[model samples]
Target: MSFQAYIDNIKAKTGKTPADFKKLAEKKGFIVKGELNPKTKATEVTNWLKEEFELGHGHAMAIYATFKGKTS
Candidate 1:
């Protein structure tokens, strides 16, 4: 899916807009760097996405990739 599509999907799943998710991620220490930092493990981010947003793996990873600019 497209990056925007993934973001839209996240919003649909969590009832949170992209901006809301960005804030939540920041609170979790996932800095919004231009790219997915090598130090920022996907598993950690995934856990937060699941616990806080109740997102599935595919959806969580899609959100993560959107934040990391890895999706297109």
Candidate 2:
């Protein structure tokens, strides 16, 4: 599937946009001031998404990608 497809499916499942995730990540300290914290690992973020949001690995990674400034 395409990247946008992954993003769309994530939204359909979670009802949240990248901007929303960004805000939550900021609150959770995955990000700081719109920047992804260098000390944070992808697995840490992905695991949090998996546990808290019930997101599968791909979807969780997509959100983590967004934290790294990707569009999808």
Query: How good is model 2 by TM-score?
Result: 0.94
What lDDT score is found at residue 31 in candidate 2?
96
- Residue pairs in steric clash, candidate 2? none
Full-model lDDT, candidate 2: 0.89
Alpha-carbon error at 22 in model 1, in Å? 1.4
Task: In angstroms, give how far residue 8 of model 1 lies from its true place.
Answer: 2.8
Q: How do the residues 1-72 of candidate 2 rate in per-residue lDDT, one tens digit apiece? A: 877888898899889988898899889898987899998999999999899889999989988998998984
For residue 22, what is the lDDT in candidate 1? 67
The per-prediction CA RMSD against the true structure, in angstroms, equals 2.7, 0.9
Candidate 1 at residue 52, lDDT? 76
CA shift at 1, candidate 2, in angstroms?
A: 1.0
- In terms of lDDT, which candidate is strongest? 2
